[model samples]
Target: MIEVSKDGGLLTLTLNRPEKANALTAAMLADLEAALAGPPPAALILTGVGKVFSAGADLEEMQAGLGRNPAWERVSAAIAAMPCPTIAALNGTLAGGAMGLALACDMRLAVTGAKFFYPVMRLGFLPQPSDPARLAALIGPARAKMILLAGARIEAEEAQAWGLIERICAPEALMTNAQALMVDALAAKAGHIAAIKALIG
Candidate 1:
C-alpha cells in the first residue's frame, strides 16, 4: 500500500495501489505513520506512483462513517510534526481527505494538469484539525471558504494563483523541480529545520 525509499537525504514515499487511484486504507495509513515516525530525514516527499495522488479514504470503509478512518488524519498531523520540510508531490488529482493531507505539507509542487477539491460539505463531513488554518494561511479565508463551503473543484493554475501550490510544472518535470526546491531546504541543519518548522507549525 506504500513504498518508501531514500536517496541521499531525500526520503520518498509512494502510495502503491495506483490501480485504485491510490485510495488509502488503514494499513496504508499505518504504513505512512510508521515511516514518518522513524529517524528524521532532511526532506520527505509524498506522492503516488501513477495518476491521482490519492482519491482520499476508501469509500467502502467510509460507509462505517468518516470517524472510522482516523489514520489519514493522524498521518497528516504526523507530516506537520516532522522536523524536516515535507513536500506533497501532486502528480495527479487530489480530493476530499487527500487534499487535507496535501495541505499539511510545507510545500506542494504539482503537475500543471492536476486538480484539487475539498468536498467536505458535499460529503457531510468537517475538515480535519489544522486543515482550515493551513488552507486559510495559504489562500486566505475567503477563498478557503469558497473551496470548503462551495465544494469547488480547483484547477492547478487557479490553485497556484491562490497560493495553494508553490509551483506548477509539466508532469515530467515535477520531480526535477521538487528536488531542486528541496535541495536548499534540506541543506539547513536538522536543528534549524526543527526550530523553523515549530515556528511555522
Candidate 2:
C-alpha cells in the first residue's frame, strides 16, 4: 500500500504495508505510479513505515509475473523526471525490485542498520530498465555488478562509503534529517528548484 501526504511544497510517499515488509503488489505499484503522475512538488521524500523499506515485489505477485510489470519502470521514470529534488529516506533494508525506486531518487539517506542489495541474479529476474544505469552512475559498474550479478548485501556504512547512500542516520532521525535536507528546496521558487536540478544534471 502507499500512503501519500502533502504539506505545501513537500510530498511524502510512504510504503505502508508493514505486515508484508512493505512488499509491493500490482495495485500498490499502480497506486505509486498514479500518485507520482501529476505535476511535480517542490520536494519529495520516498520512504517506508516498517523495518524493511520494501522486500521487493510480493512473492505471490512475482510468481504471477508482476516482476515483468511496466509499472515499475513507469514509477521509477516519473521519479527520475521530477523537476524537484527527490530523496529516498530508506528506513531499513532495500532489496529486490524496490531498489529501482531509490536508484531513481536524486539522493538516498539510510538508517544505520539498513542494508542495500538487489538480488535479481539470484531470483532470476532482470532489474527494471533504468535501474542498472542509475545504480552504476551512483556507485560504479563493478560495485553495481556485485549487487546485481553477485548478490552482495551492503551494510549502511559500506553503502555510504561506496556512494550508494548519501547519509546514514539513526532510525529516529531519518524523517527529521530528510526534512532538514529539503529546507532550501522547499523555500525556493518552484522554477528555481527545477532550474537548479536541471543544472546539476
Candidate 3:
C-alpha cells in the first residue's frame, strides 16, 4: 500500500505494509502508477511506514502472478520518468525489486540502521540490467559490481561513503532530513531540474 501526503510543496509517498516488510503488491504498483500519472508534485519523497523501506516484491504473491504481471515494471518506469526531483528515504533495509525502486529516485537518504542489497540473482532470477547502469552512475562501476555480483548488504555509512546514499541519519530524524532535502530541491527552478535530469538520463 502507499500513502501520500503533501505539505508546502513537498509530497511524501510511504510504503505502508510493515507486516510483510512493506513488500510491494501488484495493486500497490497500480496505485503508484495512478499517483505518478495524476499530478506533478513539486518534489517527491519515497519512504516506508515501518522498519523496512521495502523487502521487495511480495514473493508469495509474485509466484502466483508470475509472468502475468507487468504492472511493477510499468510503475517503476513511471517513477523513473517523473518530472520533479524524487528522493528515497530508506528507513531500513531495501532489497530485491525494492532496490530497483530506490535506484529510480534522483537522490537517496538512508537511516544509520539502513541496509541495501540486490538478491534477485540469489533467487535464480536476473535483475533488470538497466539498474546496474543507474547504480554505476550514482556510485561507480566497482561498487555497483560488488553489490550486484556479491549480493552483499551494505550499511548506511559505507553506502554514504561510496556515494550510493546522499546522507545517513538516525531513524528518528530520517523523515525530517528527507523533507528538508526536498525543500531544497523544490527551491530549484523546475525547468533546470528537469533539464539536468534529462541530460543525465
lDDT of each: 0.86, 0.93, 0.82
Candidate 2 accuracy as lDDT: 0.93
Locate the minimum summed-lDDT window of 10 residues in model 1.
Answer: 64-73
Please give each candidate's TM-score: 0.93, 0.98, 0.90
lDDT of each residue in 1-201, candidate 1, tens digit only: 899999988899988888888987777888999998889899999888787898887777678764456776788888988789889999999987778778988899998788888888998888776788889999999999998999989999999999999899888988888888788767788898888878865
Candidate achieving higher lDDT, 1 or 2: 2
Clashes of each: 0, 0, 0
**Deviation in Å, model 1, residue 170 alpha carbon:** 0.7
- Candidate 3 segments exceeding 4 Å error: 66-68, 187-189, 199-201
The total of clashing pairs for model 3 equals 0
> What lDDT is reached at residue 18 by model 3?
97
Question: Each candidate's root-mean-square deviation in Å?
Answer: 1.6, 0.7, 2.0
Candidate 1 backbone clash number:
0
Arrange candidates by lDDT, descending.
2, 1, 3
TM for candidate 3 is 0.90
